[model samples]
Target: MDTAAADGTAAGNTTGGRPGRGRGRITSIEVLCAVLLLALLGQSWLRSTLDVPALRTGATVFVAVCVQALPFLVLGVLISGAIAAFVPARVLRKVLPRKENAAVGVAGIAGVALPGCECASVPVARRLIGQGVAPAAALTFLLAAPAVNPVVMVATAVAFPGEPGMVAARFAGSLATAMTMGWLWARWGKLDWIAERALRRLPEVEPGSRWRAFTETARADLVEAGGFLVLGALISAALGVLVPAEVFGVLGEQIVLGVLVMAVLAVVLALCSEADAFVAASLTAVPLLPKLVFLVVGPAVDVKLFALQAGTFGRSFALRFAPVTFAVAVVCAVLAGLVFLGGAR
Candidate 1:
């Protein structure tokens, strides 16, 4: 009787434990199904809530921004992943000039090859620094890659079709911003400001596993950057609803105010580089200089970029870097606009 009782208890324990564990945890698919079910049930209420003009407009803007920016974002991640997997740091180091200042220029020019947004450039720059590249040059590339890349240039041209000069000014302004920041860093920047982890060398990817490395890198970047893009779009949509049209019209009448406001908006909007030109162009009331400022400043320094920099390089570095970059980018854009767009057209 004792042996039978013990055997039955053992069986009961095993069965009960397995069933309890399975029932206690929820899988992702189940959660997704639950969400879908709730959404379906709430569909009418959701529709009615979003039926207002302001909310509808905001939704449209949010969707538009996401739809326009995502392709470029994807492209950027793919290129970044390729660079990470296939282009070794030694190759970049060999290509760049030995002198930090000269390397800064080269890095800025080299950015043309990387047709991605700021989201894509940060990791590459971090990788460059980690792999023995001069911090100045890597930083220059960080500023240049998203701004002066062909993808961004083409988008700008398309956005401002008759204004070829806008494209030229944008390219020049962005390049200038990048090189200026690089030189500034070379002159006064400290290595200690950057997080130690950002500087640590990454292990080389095995040649046999390069494809796997590329896919993984691309996936990680896409997931991280995509989140920031969505957040920026949401903020932009909210601002569009909150800020009155009269405010833009009033600011546009004052050149200095317009420029400053546009700069602030660029920082706040955090639009993807490839799509920012269209958004800037859409502000019919804003003058060319302010729009130019928007284009230049968005790529160089924005809320999203600052967050990314802080995460990648450390808060200390971002605190020092973002404001300086913003100022420099604004100055460079103004100068380039005066020269190329003939004093803001």
Candidate 2:
């Protein structure tokens, strides 16, 4: 009611009448994290103490996933910083579409230029869309940036060992999924709701001052993008520990199961597109088609990716859009699998 009370309310102090809702909001987040951690610990202890092999198996899966991808998380952030600093936003925007379909194609091409994990792509894509990029193009970049980068290609090659075809499948599969998802979203989804889709002109700094701009942009981007990348890795790790691997094996053999595996990996790995190929290749236990699905889906969707979409667009957009993308991506992966990777080698 009063000025002091209003300030208190904003500060999240409930005791003071009219406490700040904003301040309370931050505190609530911390409290939620603490509660989750405690629950995880309790479940972990109970599962271990009970000597249940299945329970321990879930925890192992969660931890393995998180730890396996932590390095890539850091790498993605560092690379993102460089893009923010040295690369002009306008340069990226210029490459995107004046039309919807072109926008998606441009976004996919743009993905090769900026190498980062799924989480890192969120901010970069947001900046492009916020600046003047079309929704179709931004979505394309959002799906492709993680999957099509050079770093990821090398990783795929290495992970597949003797199989060059594996690398090819990953690249082609990812490309197909990115392009298809973009066109689909533009055609059927609620394009009107995407806040970042309509980017305007990016602010221009003088050419002479480019070095200074690079340094400043890189610093801020590393902090923002890198932080989220770590958060994503942690979520993936938790999922890995909680789910059993063998369960994913049988399903991976079937066309439907392969899609489902990809969908789940999209949620579990939370990896950058550039790095996910290697991870997918290493999964020799799963069918080739399923691994391809994993590669395609990870870049398009993940828990952290959803969190970012919610923040940038709105909860409603993320809630509906992620599932839609998941379904579409699975279907695309299935089609790709059938065409190329359907039969076992």
Candidate 3:
């Protein structure tokens, strides 16, 4: 009687466990099916909604900008990777001046060599700082690389057509902004504001494996910077459509208003430095000074650049650096414009 009762109890337990296990499997399958259905519905909704003219234009512009900028960004990352893999940190330190101020000047001048957009410069600058290069110098490179590079200068000349002076003015204004900011930081910037981990050099790879290191570094930077580039392009394309073209038509003789407007536009648009010159040239109602300001401020301090800086240098540093760079860039651009483009046409 006891054996029969025990066997019956075991049978009851087994029967109860099976349904619970089956219910769990059924629930999981239902959830996965629901997710797949939702995704399909969302995709269909997006296709219908994005058929409007404004959105279509925005999408086209976004694609064009991304296509235009990707090659330059890839090249910049490759150079950065080469520098990381081939150049020892000690070699960089030896090349840069020991004095922070002198190093800052050199760094600003060195910007002429790198010919990529602001997206490419942030990681390279962070790497420089990590290699024990002075923060001030690294910051200067961050500002100057996108602004004063030969590619940007050439593009400015091409965009402006007859104006050789625009190229000269852009170069001067950008360099001045970068150098001035570097000096300011050298005098009063606190070291603690930078993330501690960002300051340390990366672990050295084996000498024989440098080629592998180069490819890996380049690939990583390309992936990271490419994401930000796409985002910035989207933002620019959206603003291009949403902001009325007629708004720029009314600023006839308002020099101060134009400068302020252009500066604000520069920050909001966050156009690539290489491409911003063409956009500025297209704004026929805007004065040369304002256009110059747009070119300078866009490269040195804009929405995208601010995001990049904050991500790399920590929020505290970016908060301080971006505002100061913006103000300096605006002032330098105005001064350079007055000298080069003049107050008139």
Name the weakest run of 10 consecutive residues (lDDT summed) in model 3: 16-25
Report residue 340 deviation for candidate 1 (angstroms).
2.6
173-286 per-residue lDDT for model 2 (tens digits): 777778877888778767556654333344555678776765665556555544544555455444445545776566655657666756696676566564465455445456
The ten-residue window of minimal lDDT in model 1 covers 15-24
CA lDDT, every model vs. true structure: 0.87, 0.66, 0.79
Instruction: Using TM-score, give the best candidate's number.
Output: 1
In candidate 2, which residue ranges exceed 4 Å CA deviation? Answer: 1-75, 189-191, 195-249, 252-255, 278-282, 342-345
Highest lDDT against the true fold, candidate: 1
Error of 2 at 186 (Å): 3.4
User: Tens digits of per-residue lDDT for model 3 on 1-345?
Assistant: 999999988897787566456544667678999998987879878788777999998887777767666655666667767766776655655778989999999889888865445776787777788878899998888888888887677777776888998999999999999999999999999989997867878665579999998898888877766775676677667666886866655554767887898899889877667666656765656678888988999989988788888888889988998888889999999889888887535
Task: Judge candidate 3 against the unseen true structure and give its global Cα lDDT, from 0 to 1.
Answer: 0.79
Error of 3 at 196 (Å): 1.3
